[model samples]
Target: MKRIGMLTQIFIGFVLAIILGVIFGPSIAVVQPLGDLFLRLIKFIVVPLVLASLITGITSLNNVNKLLSLGGKTIVYFLATTFFAVLIGLAAGFILSPGKGVDIALPTESAEKAEAPGITETLLNFIPVNPFESLTNGNILQIIFIAIAIGIAITTVGEKAKPLADFFEALAQVMYKITGFIMKLAPIGIFGILAPIVGNYGLDILLPLLKVILAVAIGCLLQVLVTYSIAVRTLGKMSPLAFIKGIAPAGIVAFTTASSSGTLPVTIKNTQENLAVSKEVSSFVLPLGSTINMDGSAIYQGVAAVFIAQFFGVDLSMGQIVTIAFMAVVVSIGAAGVPGAGLIMLTMVLQSVNLPLEGIALIAAIDRILDMFRTSTNVIGDASAAVVVQHQENKASLAKSA
Candidate 1:
């Protein structure tokens, strides 16, 4: 017999979990270790996966100056869109109130809510004085800073630094392989995790999950239909209908695979042939967008962070809200363009503001569902950047001739 697809397996597990929860009620908590074990496995990989992948990702860019000169328009467009995407997610979270009706126990430490840090204090904490201390503490933002600093230095030092860059690049591959291994256990983990949530809270808990799903789905649609549509029509001089039609093939691939990197060939092909982007423009912008542009993931993070906060009854202050948007954008720089990468990135968003990690399990069971929508949005966003950049370059060339 053929193997079951990962999403199918996960859906099966999700259904079974709810059934078990309803059947056994609170008694089903005995299987909780399955969830804990899965979480620990994910936690084991997070630090190394992020550190190595981030370092390699930055190192691969090699010359930051070269990127700015060649892909500057694409980069700025991506950054602006990503920032707006997060705000949209925040709005969806607050307005839709996805996590409002749920009541779950939070960790004792998390239960004692700390004062929200000021903007200055938040910035100061990102610069790990002792990098090792940050690693030991799992200070994600600091770790990202260290990775960026080291990666840039490696690039600046030139050929002599090849060995260090190679090491990290290889380590990143290893971590990715390990993460793939762990993800296979997701069905069991979801079963363990969700069963208890349903058992205690009853089926009403599933309503929030549905709302979470709706919020993210709506965000994805808005990003594509509203954000990218306007971007292509205004700056790219391409109609929204044309942009949507042209990018549909790649977007479908990205949605099914939930991996931006995996969908690049289709994206490049569609951007060039369908969208009329020059090969040079499509080649540079789409690939870079794949690595760093994550408007959809940003939206998901914003919604998930707010949902976690609400679920835990943790009141989010303005500073905390800003922190979520900032962290989502920053972490997007290093997030892997693979399936389920959002789950790991979500941890960073949660850690930024001291939200409970256990809340991850609450969302984990349905992550693949959200991943589909976000990955599709990400691919389309990348293609849209190519369209816009090609237009800007064309205008500049015409100006120079004149």
Candidate 2:
């Protein structure tokens, strides 16, 4: 019965959203507020979730070096995966020719003329001058780095911080519970969000870019199913098929929710229940993944950058391609958990090559439609990591048993 209820709600939400969006067009504006509300609710919880979860996850670990090792491995894997994703995007955008011969006019927005941050400032600002303001402004990397520091401090204080440690542990549990409760409304929120999205653009939006979207989706799926599968099967030594199965719920939820952080709770739940990962690992890794490991979004940004470049009749040289790859990696790190995030990241990429910012307005029309695909891929990547983590622990357990 629980299974039935889950399936029913999800299916209904998706079907209804598409139907309503197609029929009403932008007149679905009434429901647009729900999308904003839903995103706000998710944003409201992110800071607390990171602080509590990181503190608890960190304090629980006896070996601080293991945390560093995990961080290093995760970042290395994320970078490799993102680099490949960017390559796939650039290659496909170049090969399939997504932006060729279009009569689309660019939208005029005042902000388009403004300069985006340079590589150095963007890097420096990541550390944050004021941590509190970073949180207030929704700077995810800053918030994450701060949580890591707080967590390490809690660990270092040891017994002296027992009471505080206990308090944060409880706080983590509370946040997880709140996240669980809020997730129940995801179906309704998804419906409300999609109703207007479909209404505003309709299927016609995909007309020009369907092939490109498909190419991008293929690249995303390859990253999740192929690249991640190898990581789980070889490095983590899990059954790749089982890993994919475990992540299905989270992937589907991501597809529907389209917010990695918003889907974090679902990813955690799915990792534990379906993937059989330990709570400790899931608690530690999933939140961080939500912030920094956006393999799917990275893929979209790479593809979209090249697509925009081509669409605007901008012929990028080999050096420019390398530049795009470099910029994509850096911008992707800063893009964590921002709503409609890929568009912003793509804007940064376009500006790097001196491409017209007007190109962004063209992509904006179809961004929501393409976003659904990439978000699913993002959640899949999260689940794959959880599965790999579990696989490593299981191997350790087996060794101990032997």
The reply for model 1, stretches above 4 Å from the true place, is 1-68, 103-208
lDDT for residue 266 in candidate 2, whole number 0-100: 73
Q: Count the backbone clashes (under 3 Å) in each candidate.
A: 0, 2
The pairs that clash in candidate 1 are: none
- Model 2 bad stretches (over 4 Å): 1-8, 32-37, 108-114, 135-138, 239-241, 393-402
325-351, model 1: which lDDT tens digit per residue? 999887665565777778877887899
> How high is each candidate's TM-score?
0.61, 0.88
TM-score of 2: 0.88
For residues 1-402, what per-residue lDDT tens digits would candidate 2 score against the true structure?
A: 356665467668878888888888888878877767766676678777777777777777756886776666566766777777777777767777778876666656423344556668766866878987978876766777777887788778788989988998898888878877776776777787778877877667678668667877887877876788888888777788887776765676677567787777777777777678777677677777776677777778778877777787788898888888888877776665645787777778877788777777777777776777877777777667666665665676598799
